[model samples]
Target chain A: MRYIASAVFVIGVFVIVTAVTTQHAAKLDPYMYDYMIENFEDDTHAKNAVAAILLDYRMYDTMFEALILLTAIIGMKQFLPGAADLRARDELESVDQTEATGEQSSERPSE
Target chain B: MSGPVSDTMPTDESIVLQMVVGLLYPFMLLFGFYVILNGHYTPGGGFQGGSVLASLFVARYVVYPVDDTDTETLHSIQRVFLALIVIAPSAVLFTGVIARNPEFRSLYLTTMDVLIGVQVGFGLGVAVLRFAFFQGVGKTWHL
Candidate 1:
């Protein structure tokens, strides 16, 4: 029952997204790119329109791309057992009141 | 409690070598930042730059011994710095989500460069620390 509900929810979301995208597609402004190119110097000093588009005009996309990179790093850290241990140990050390024992754990064995 | 590793006083020559490696580490870090900062106009970017910086820490561990001054404190510092590295990029993204401009754009590349530098620096530091702690020093005795 849960699987069926999840499948339905996923399909429902897909359908809604497709519908919205199709609607937006139909109303696309073809001249917008041309207009931006024509007005490039007036608005931004970028020599390359594409660079301007990516860095300035559409910097949000670039930001999200960076976010994706960050997410991948976080995901990698989570998936790696050693990283997980380090994270856990760090958290424990911060919260625990135990005195810093002079002895230190042996360094992790090199791969 | 795991007992402290026997404090073998590094000879003057060994200390000199370690100091040289330590000094070099900062320059390597600076170079990594250079790559990241000039990424907008140049070929190298955050990811590449960060990895290069991180590798220096690994190099440091390989070249030096895990002494009292360099082990636990350095490892803890790396962990803390890496945590910040993991957080800084997300914070920028969160700000973007909340601002919700119709364009949905952000001035995040600079932030990305800084965060990647931290991540690479800290991540490498941790890895080197772990390596030094676990593997002990290499066969080449500097002293």
Candidate 2:
């Protein structure tokens, strides 16, 4: 069943890849990129075109990215392990655990 | 109180690593400050400069070790900067609230960048300190 599912997924991906055409991206005006590149600085005052576009036009996406980072950090702080308990986070599977001092663990010693 | 766990680095020392880090850390700090101050006109900005500054602490750890950062102070600094990030811009943006100055917009951006750099630096410092403390290599703070 797993193999059959994998085969179907591969076929679906192949069909999707083959079906995409440039017609969807065909712009009415081909000079849009040039125009945007030239004008972004004038409008936003940012020297970097990429920064101008991302920060000027699409700041919300960046906001979401920041939100994700904060959320992950907060989640880790809240749920990483018990208070007064010290150990590497990934040491759950090993029978011999390194204390939070990280004296011994399955991971490389240098790490 | 759930304050930061203060940990001093171990006495184990390497002269070569210490010397190199001592030499490099100052330059890294200067570059980080430059990035923050010049973000409006240059390629680097608040986040980049802040990360660069944060790297100094990590390097110190690699050479010496304990994310010996004081979390309480860091938290306060982050708060202050976060306030600056909001207040500085809004004061300029809402022209009627403060005297309307033509140059306020550009000033706002530059100041915001500075505040952001400070905040990011503090934040990353806190993270490194916590990691060291929890990892158990860090010596607890004295005094």
Candidate 3:
């Protein structure tokens, strides 16, 4: 039963991907590349056409890419065993050490 | 608490490896910066350059595993870079400044590239350092 369900799910995903790719290819205008090449400098003011495409023409994608990096770091922090706890304890130890030294210095002048 | 792991791995035995990496370090850093700064005029961009920069940490580990990095500070700064990455483009897009001044387009492209390069470099560097610490090598901080 599990094998049949897994096979059916894989086939469904493949069909969806193929249909989307074919539809996308049929709708794409070949001359769009020519247009970008001719006017990218004027439109985006980038010397490199690829830079113009990445930073100007498709900027939202780059923004979300940064977001993904941030999210990955946050998630990794949660999984690393005892790392956060150790960092917190180190900070606390520094604070307590400072306080203890301060008390010793103050008591010495009075004594 | 954990056992007293040495602050730095015993790397004094390998003088040749240390010298070689020390010689190559600055050049690799300069190349990474060049790739990022010249992204507007070249094939390389932020992601590629950032990975190059992050590789320096791995190299440092290979030579001497030292948990000298302030991951807390790096964590904060990387998030700030992400915020700038999101804000800079949206501000330009919404304020319609680029439409009024074509020159701003070049400046914006350069800024985004630098911001992204720094963000990725620091983020990946922090991840690698954290992983190293998790492996029980830090002398002071136990994990």
Candidate 4:
């Protein structure tokens, strides 16, 4: 029974993905590339069509891609212990030592 | 802290040395941003920019001794900036899912650029600090 259920779930996902891809394929216009290439000179002044496409037409995409790089850094910092905690403890120790010295100096005459 | 151990001493010369070292930080930071902003048109992009930004820490270390500059406080600031690096890209990715655009392939590039910049910067900074403070040995300091 479990095998049958698993098989059915897999099949259902496959069908959904296939349907979506087919729908997208139908909507794609091949001629749009030619149109972009023809107008590339007048608008962006970029020599490479690919550069024009990326920087001008798809600038937003480029921005988000940069964000992805940022996220990875964050993730690494979170997951890795690194030297952050060690550095913090060192500061606390120094502070504690200073306070202890101050207390001893004040009490020296009284004792 | 007593009588200035040679290791802990901030010599008079070191002060002048630190000031000179500090002068170069802004330029390094600005260059990183320049690389990031022009990445779309030029050879470098966010990854390079992030690295350039992170290099500022290294510049600081080289100019001033770690003991003189309070490494502990700097670590906290590093954590906050690193967190921003992680959260920003995730937010972008989450937007794509909410919008239900499975074919939103363009989102990948933006996220990649930002995260790479952050990773390069943070990674380089941390690596430099770790190696420097630890003296390239695997021994861990208890702080």
Misplaced by over 4 Å in model 1 are A1-111, B1-8, B12-26, B67-107, B135-143
Q: Over the stretch A15-88, how does candidate 4's per-residue lDDT look in tens digits?
A: 99999998887656869888898986455544446545654566567555544644544565465544556557
Q: Which pairs of residues have clashing backbones in candidate 1?
A: A59-B106, A60-B105, A60-B106, A107-B133, A107-B134
lDDT of 4 by residue, B1-143 (tens): 34323343334335666777678777887888777655545667665787788778766655544433333444455455556545654564445552354344344444444545655566566555655665312222221
lDDT of 1: 0.55
TM-score of chain B, per candidate?
0.55, 0.78, 0.86, 0.56
lDDT of 3 by residue, B66-134 (tens): 667677788899999999998998889657888898877777888888998999999899888888778
- Taken over the whole model, the C-alpha lDDT of each candidate is 0.55, 0.62, 0.81, 0.57
Say what the interface RMSD of candidate 3 is. 1.8
Best by TM-score: 3
Question: Native-vs-model 4 lDDT?
Answer: 0.57
TM-score of each: 0.41, 0.61, 0.74, 0.42
Candidate 2 chain B: minimum summed lDDT over ten consecutive residues — where? B134-143
The digit string of per-residue lDDT tens for model 1 on B1-143 reads 23454344444336566778778888887888888766544566556777787777665554554432243454455455545544654564445652454232223445555555555555555554544444233222222
Instruction: Provide the lDDT at A47 for model 4.
Output: 46
Superposition error at A50 for model 3 (Å): 1.6
Candidate 1: residue A36 lDDT (0-100): 85
TM-score for candidate 2? 0.61
lDDT of 2 by residue, B50-106 (tens): 999888777866765543455556656666666665555445544443234434434
Q: What would the DockQ be for model 2?
A: 0.13
Give the native contact fraction of candidate 1. Answer: 0.00
DockQ of each: 0.04, 0.13, 0.54, 0.05
